[model samples]
Target: MNQTYHVYILASARNGTLYTGVTGDLAQRMWQHRNGKGAKFASKYGVHRLVHAEAFTNVNDAIAREKAIKKWRRAWKLELIERGNPQWLDLYDRLNG
Candidate 1:
C-alpha cells in the first residue's frame, strides 16, 4: 500500500507557541504530542493542538515542506495556519473522528 506523509503544525493555543513536524501517521503523531511523548520542544511548550497540516504522497516532499515551514518567520507561519484554520482549532479530534 502507498503511504502518506504529512507536514503538520501544532500550537499551544490560538496565537500561542508553535511546533512544526513531519509524520507518516498524523493521527499517531498527534496522539504522541497530546500525551507528552512527541518532540521535546512541543512537550516543553505544551504545543499539542493541531493547527495546520498538509499531506503528500511522497515522503521527500513532506519532509521538504516541513523543513521550509520550520524556517519560516512566525508571522508567515501564523498566516499559513490562519488561512486554513482561522480559529486555530485543535484538529486532533477532527483527524480521529
Candidate 2:
C-alpha cells in the first residue's frame, strides 16, 4: 500500500521562533529550509531546523494535521518537536543521505 502524509512544524535557529508548514516531500523540503531557500518564513526567521513532522495517509489528512498543529501553543509545539525530534536535528540529511 502507498501512503502519503502531510506534516506541520515550527523551526527556529538555536532557541526560539516557530515556522509551520506542510510538505509531501519532507526530506527535500527540509533541505531547502536548511539552505534558507525553502520559504520566506524560514529565511526571515532563521527557522532552519527540522523540529517536527507528521505522516498522514492522505493529503487532506496532512493538511488537517498541519492546520491543527499551527493552532497549538508554543509550549505544545516545543513538546511536539521534542516528541519526534528530541535533539532538534535537521532530519533532511539522514533522509537524503
What's the lDDT for all of these models?
A: 0.93, 0.76
Q: Quick one: best lDDT, which candidate?
A: 1
Error of 1 at 92 (Å): 0.6
In the range 46-73, model 2's lDDT, one tens digit per residue, is 8776666677778888888788888888
Measured against the true structure, the TM-scores of the candidates, in listed sequence, are 0.97, 0.81
TM-score of 2: 0.81
Show the colliding residue pairs in model 2: 5-56
Q: Write the per-residue lDDT of candidate 1 for residues 27-54, one digit (tens) a residue.
A: 9999898898999999999999999999
Worst 10 residues of 1 by lDDT: 88-97
Where does candidate 1 stray beyond 4 Å? Answer: none
